[model samples]
Target: MRQNLSVEEALEAILEGARPIAELEPLPLAQAYGRTLGAELSARVSHPAADDTAVDGYACREADTRGASPENPVRLRVVGLAPAGQPFSQEVGPGQAVQVFTGAPIPLGADAVVRVEDTRREGEFVWLLRPASPADIRRRGEDLVEGQTYLHKGDLLTPARVGLAAAMGHPVLPVVRRPRVGLLTTGDEVVEPGEPLPYGGVYNANSYTVAGLVEEAGGEPVFLGKAPDSPEELRTHLAQTQGLDLLVTTGGVSMGERDVVRKLLEAEGQIHFWRVRIQPGGPLLWATWNGLPLLGLPGNPVSAMVSFLLFGRPLLFRLLGRSDPPYQQLRAVAETRFEANPARRAYRRGILRWAGGYRVASTGSQSSVVLRSMAVGNALVVVEAGKPVRAGEEVEVIPLPGGKTAG
Candidate 1:
């Protein structure tokens, strides 16, 4: 097993064996929001199927409106009316005109449209104050062409894309199925929330936190409940993940005497890596058991959450057939001094604000067990190993989700 790997090296090892789900399902346009497209979608029909009028006016031959102006207007007999979706069956001759509303199909033999503002109507006759032009007509298939592929495979179905699909005559869309991820929290000191807390016991925050992160990454999280630090109990809980694509466990991955998860995996499953060179989340583990991929995260609240953001989220995206980067990085000036860790890369929680430029300040103590630090922080300041940053120095920063608002 590879031990003490860098952040990038461990991620490479974890995703080398990852594969996107193959199953595809058809969903109604309304329910397919945020889902990935399973196959290429082509337009079933053309928009504006025929030459249509773009304004409320009269459809007449351009020759009939020649030399027409307010000083010497041309008058033509109004023969018929053409509203939207209804066509005027008769041909518009040189001395005749057809009243056309917006989106109405232009009458046969009419090559120009004169806006209503440029004409004066008097009962059966209408006067053309200005010469009409053919530019006022919208040609057939102007917006969308028949059989044209507008949405490609692996495309994300956003709101505008959904509307475009509807306009292309699709009532439903073929979308890739969401990956199912199994979450298991192991530790005797952890108990479910709302349950009476025993002495020196803590609530099971990892389950809910990891579950939420899974959902945000476009995966369905299946809770496997909490398991005490025992080989038998862990095996029983693991057996529940028969059809799951991935398994994630919090705690029991370090070298503590009670850390039985690693021992069991080493004896049964294939271990790919053991630890990462990252502060607050160094005890990371990746393995495969009976053909199922398992990712073990640290036990601390902050460590589990941050490690998932960096590693687990990308794995979920790969399974969904997406190529989005794990996080958005930028350079920001430091508002306060940031201490350095000589041994491992550190992800320090901080708050970012826009003041002519992005300025970041630490969010107090950077302890692994402090969950409040993540709550109050809007960004993560990356401090490279053995690099200490002073105030006013530029540093690498990754803005947290939904924290891009300007100060």
Candidate 2:
């Protein structure tokens, strides 16, 4: 097995450096988020059925209202009114106007909307000052043509993207189902949560934490909980992942006597690599059991998280068939002088926010045991192994919770 690798090398191994996640079941549109998009969604009946109002304004015939200036002004009869969510098919005669709200369909025979602001209303007739131009009109299907394609296949269904699909008339969205992940955590010193922790022992947060991250990354997290260091226990855990799309384990990956996770996996599965040249997350591991993907992350909080992000997260996303197989990476500037001289990639827990036009990040302490930093941090500042970075320098970052956070 390979050892002492860069974070990218570990990620490449996790991506299998080759074979992709097998196909998954078809999913519904409503439950698409936290799942991947396997197929592209096409337009059913096009969009914006016809020329409609883009703003709340008066719909008037262009010919009748054209050149109706502020000085001379043209008077037009108000024949009818139309509100949003409703459309009127009645044709507008010359010198006639229709009170229109935003999104209201422009009546037939009317080519322009002289905004209500530009027109003075009367009981039956309205006085228009500004000249209505072709620009004022939202041409029929101007937003989308008939049978035009709106959403492409293989796009992640974010709230905004999902909304777009909904607008495009996807009733039952055809999406790839969330890939199921079997989460296994191993450590002799680690105890199951909700129980007593003896001296030098703590609860198992990696299981729940990484599971949550898996879900946010668009996969179903199957909580396998903590597995003992025994080969039988490890075998049972690995066996339980029979139908799962992926299996991710925390701890028991280092080359220690008690680090039996890899050994147990090796009994049946093939070990591809072990160890990485990264701070806080060096003892990373990867394997394949019966053709199912397996990941062995460092047990420390920060290491596990970094391993999950750089390795497991993207693999899970692709397996689920996310519209975008690989997630989008963002760039941010270092908010303060951050120090690291480790021989491996350093993922510093930190917070990032927008200042002026730049997104800057501050490095929180890089301690693997620090949970408070993870709680407060919005982004993970990525520093290459042995790379020294100063304040105002640029670095890569991944959001902590995987969505927009409220300041």
Candidate 3:
């Protein structure tokens, strides 16, 4: 097991063993949102399969209404009406026009459309105030081309992509199955929310936070309940998750006497790496137990959450086969001075503001125990090891989930 590894080194090691599943499933377009595409998607049919009108108008040959104004209107015989989904079967003649509504396919011989507001109907005669141009007609295959690949493999099925698939006449899409992850929060001092807490015990917030994060990253989280700091109880809980793709445990990763998670994993599982050089979340442990990926996070609420954001979330996205996850790193100027750790990198919770440029201000108190600072923060201002930054100094920030940032 490698101890005291750099953040990049640990991440490289962790991902070396993580591989995306090969199984694919077909899902309906409406149910595929947030799922990763397992296969590239191509349009089966062209959007607007035929040339159509952009507005309710008179579809006629441009030469038929060459020069006409309000004072000297051109009169053309209205032969037929074409509404949406129905087209005039007859070809437009030299002195005749087809009345077409918006989205109606243009008649066979028509080359232009004059807006309805520009013409008036008198029984069988339609008056044109001005000449029309061919540009008013929407050409066939204007939105999507048949046999063209619009969505690539590993792309997340967003609402826009879903709409595109449907527009191209695809009712179903191939997508990767969501990864199943087992969440276990260990330690006797932790109690589930809504349960009466005994003396010296605190409510377990990491379970819910980790569960929500897992779901947001396209993984299904299965709560395995809290495990006491005992080798037998921890082993029993770990044994019950034989079908999960990954196991994430909070607490019992540090060098404390009660840290049974690491102790148990070391005795049974293969430890890949531990102790990343990061403040507030340095004691991160990565291991594999019976061919299952296991991640052990620190006991502190902020540390566990930050560790998951930096590492666990990306791993889940990888398992889902997403080439690009939603988590992003951007540059911002520090609004206030911040001290850095002498030997470890720090991720300080803060709110990002955009005035003339992106600016980040620290949420009060950077203690790992204070989860509220993380609750109100929109970004994690990254400070390199041994490099303190002053006000107005530029730094890298990782945007948190669902938080709005400056443009």
Best by TM-score: 3
- Put down candidate 2 lDDT per residue, 1-407, tens digits, no spaces: 77777767777667655333456565456766544455666666545677778777788778787678789889999888899777776989887888899778888888888878887877898999887655765666665554667666566677777777677777666666667789888877888878898998878889888988887787788888778778888777677777787888888887788888877766767888888887777888788788876788888887898778777777866565454545455787777866675666677777777765446455466688887677777777777767877887888877665645334
Mind giving the per-residue lDDT tens digits that candidate 3 earns over 156-250? 88899899989988899989988999999999999888999999999999999899989989999999999999999999998899789999999
Worst 10 residues of 3 by lDDT: 317-326
Clashing pairs in 2: 40-153, 51-140, 154-323, 155-323, 277-344, 278-344, 278-345
Q: TM-score of every model?
A: 0.86, 0.88, 0.96
Q: Count the backbone clashes (under 3 Å) in each candidate.
A: 0, 7, 0
lDDT of each: 0.91, 0.74, 0.91
Candidate 2 structure lDDT: 0.74
- Candidate 2 vs candidate 3, lDDT winner: 3
Whole-model lDDT, model 3: 0.91
- RMSD each, Å: 3.2, 2.9, 1.5
